[model samples]
Target chain A: MSLPHAILTALLEKPSSGLELTRRFDRSIGYFWSATHQQIYRELGKLEQAGHIRALPAPTPARGQKKEYEVLPAGRAELTEWVARSEDPKPLRSALLLRMRAAAVVGAPGMREELRRHLDLHRRQLEEYRAIEVRDFPPARRESEPDRLRHLVLRGGIDLERFWVEWLTQALGELER
Target chain B: MSLPHAILTALLEKPSSGLELTRRFDRSIGYFWSATHQQIYRELGKLEQAGHIRALPAPTPARGQKKEYEVLPAGRAELTEWVARSEDPKPLRSALLLRMRAAAVVGAPGMREELRRHLDLHRRQLEEYRAIEVRDFPPARRESEPDRLRHLVLRGGIDLERFWVEWLTQALGELER
Candidate 1:
């Protein structure tokens, strides 16, 4: 449902092919939403069939042929309608916690090790986020309005990672004791 | 894959009826993973049939017949093996960011409103997290080494929410200008 909107949004930012969209998704919006190459290609076909976007005829210099897409007026209208009307909270599905809950049956020791691993992963993520902040925003602009918002989202990611690390440490300690 | 483990873990915490497991999931593990009552019941049946969990005779209850579940030795072994394995990184799937990217098409005005609404929701989440911190951990304990991990996780949630609010304000300003 929202996939069309996501596709349209990506196209709106700039005309792109299914391959390009997948790449862009990884680099930019990938920070928030992700789609597999298969999913992206499938959605692109649907959007084109629906007349939301059209593939522009173009040739690549050295790479395989890439189809460029631009949102049609209809696509723009549909995206607007979706933005205005869609209110359902997107459900989140996580397998990690499921594994943790299941681990409780096996015993506490294994669960502690799993959590320690999770903590390490999160700590690394926080470091990556901090690096993005430093590289993406200039020093003076870091405090500026627009940069602040960008920084804030990155901060959110960092904070969540930090929290996970903290929770793992505490929970692991309790389990050990 | 993790479903079997989660059920075992819940049972380890305490023996529970299928209905009780559903409720416990809503309160604790639901924060990270979610499952419906139907899924819980179905999983329990599978586990019982597979010899991973044993269902005790139904007890006469005030409202209905309750079937309690206890983990079998095999289940414990399976869960331990699972814990030792590494989990793949789950893909991000945030509707908010998808909407924000789409906002690039609707021009600035409508997008600003959406961003503002998101910011408000995050603010409420921040407040909820802060309440959890105060209610769940004592100040002194929060500062301790073990507790510090849990504290960091909570701080992450807080910081993330705060970052969203700040980003909303600045992004809105940028759109206005």
Candidate 2:
């Protein structure tokens, strides 16, 4: 469901080929909603068949022919309806947490070790998020509206990571004792 | 990788049957990792065969039987290894952001509606988080360590959602102009 929505949403911005959608997914959508290249390709075919999108023939620039796609009116209407509807709250899906919950039952020693390891992982994530923020939105270049929006999203990522690290730290401390 | 690890980690906490593991996954691990009951059952069998976990004979109830599983030493070593190592950051996977990025390309009108919709969603999430915090950790219960940790995670969720709504609000304001 999300995959089709993502593709239509992408086309709504502008028409692009399956390949272009894959690239955009990597650079931007991957930040939040990840789809494999295979998944994107598969969905494009499905959407096109459903008439939610139309593929336009592209002239070969040099050696390769690329097909571009645009959201059809039906696609736009579907997307609009989706946007207007309420969404269910999807739960967080982290493997690490599953392990932690099980650890409580396993015994303290092993659980303690696992918690320590998670703490280190969270720390690394916090560092990486910070780096992405600096790389993606250097303060000097954050003057435009889009840049500002990007910065805000980046900040949310950084803050969430920081919180995880802090929680892991505190949890580790408790387990150590 | 995550599936087996999740099962093994849970077993390490305490040996449990597939039924118990599913319940635990719903209550706690559900916050991070989610899996269907079918997946859990399949993985448990795989883990036992792979020598990562062991299934003990079911206690004689003289009627129905359910086998309990414990993580083997090999499993413990694996979990520890995973904890100690740096996890490759999972790609940012967000559907909402993909929509926003696509909106940017499509032109302002549609994008504005998308942003407004997202903002409303985030605002509602923030409220939900607050309600969970209050319900889970009333002021009197806040002094416990576990409660505090739970509260912290909830607070983080609340803050992140709030940040998103605020940013979307501002972004929408500009896009409307």
Candidate 3:
């Protein structure tokens, strides 16, 4: 459900073909939200059926060809309504935490390695986010509304990666002790 | 599923009936992992069927009668295996982030208020986590292996709440300008 809205927002930002959306998702939206190509294609079909989006005119509309989509007025209205609605924060569901709980019962053999892998992954993600910050926002630049909102979301990812990297290091240190 | 493993770990800590498990989930386990009562009941049944756990014999064998369960050795082994298994970190998927993305397209009318609500919720959650830390893990005390692991998981919850609280405060300040 949110995927459609996410797609709608992405399309609103700039109309793109299915392939283009997938590429954008891989780079930007994929940071916060993720979906497989199959999932994206499926949602696009549903959105088009629901009249929230439609394929822009193309000369050769055939299989494997580009199919650009733009959010309809109805989609914009829906997104605005969703933006104003209050939603509860989802419960934190970390598989790592569950593993930690299980590790308590089963003895933490090989747990340190898993933590290390997570630490490395987070470190890489942090680097990617920082690179984006440097490239997109840069220093000493006036930010537009869209830029500010985008940066706010980016800030969350950066902070989250920081939390994981820091926590994992401490956890590894705890293991050593 | 991780929920079943989480259940096995909790039951390893203390034998509990379905109702007790639900309460525990609501309080502690629910912090990092959550489940509906129906989901709990279903998992309990499956775990019992799979020989990971069994009901403690009770005098009254009536419907709705409390049927306490305890983890078997098989369950412990399964949990240990799960702890050692390497899982890719779950992608970050905050509906608030999604809404924030959507807001960029449609003006942010009620975003500040939503952020305030989230701020309060995270603050309360942090208080609860800290209270647990005080009650369960007082200072200058040697923690058992299990206690340490549990505390590490709790530490994650505390830090995450702190992140949200700080980030939301900063985000609100950004909105003012």
Q: Which candidate is the best by TM-score?
A: 3
Evaluation by TM-score, superior candidate among 2 and 3: 3
Put down candidate 1 lDDT per residue, B1-177, tens digits, no spaces: 766677787887788998899998776555455688999998998998999899876656444677888988887777777766777656567676566556545743356666667767777777887888888776777654435544544554465566666766765666666
Q: Model 2 captures what fraction of native contacts?
A: 0.32
Give the clashing residue pairs of candidate 3, or none: none
lDDT of 1 by residue, A1-177 (tens): 767788788888789988889998887666677788899989998999999999886765345677788999999988887766636344345565455444433433455666777778777877887888778866776664435545555555665566566656666765665
Considering every candidate listed, which one attains the maximal lDDT?
3
Chain B TM, per prediction:
0.73, 0.65, 0.96
Per-residue accuracy of model 2 over B9-81 as CA lDDT, tens digit each? 6676568988899998775454467777899999988887888888786557443478788888898877766
Work out the TM-score per prediction: 0.73, 0.65, 0.97
Local accuracy by lDDT, each model: 0.70, 0.67, 0.88
Tens digit per residue, CA lDDT, model 3, B1-177: 689988998899899999899999999888889988888999999999999999999998999898999998898888988989999998888888888878877888899999999999999999999998999887544368777877888898899999999989988887778
Better model by DockQ: candidate 1 vs candidate 2: 1
For model 1, the superposed segments whose C-alpha errors exceed 4 Å read A58-65, A86-136, A139-177, B59-65, B111-177
Tens-digit lDDT track of model 2 for A1-177: 678887887777668887888998776555577788899988998999999998775565433467788889998877766644445446556544444444433433455565566667767767876888778778786777656655655655665566667766766765565
Query: Which is better, 1 or 3, measured by lDDT?
Result: 3
Q: Give Cα distance to truth, residue B101, candidate 1, Å.
A: 2.7
- What value does DockQ give for candidate 2? 0.26
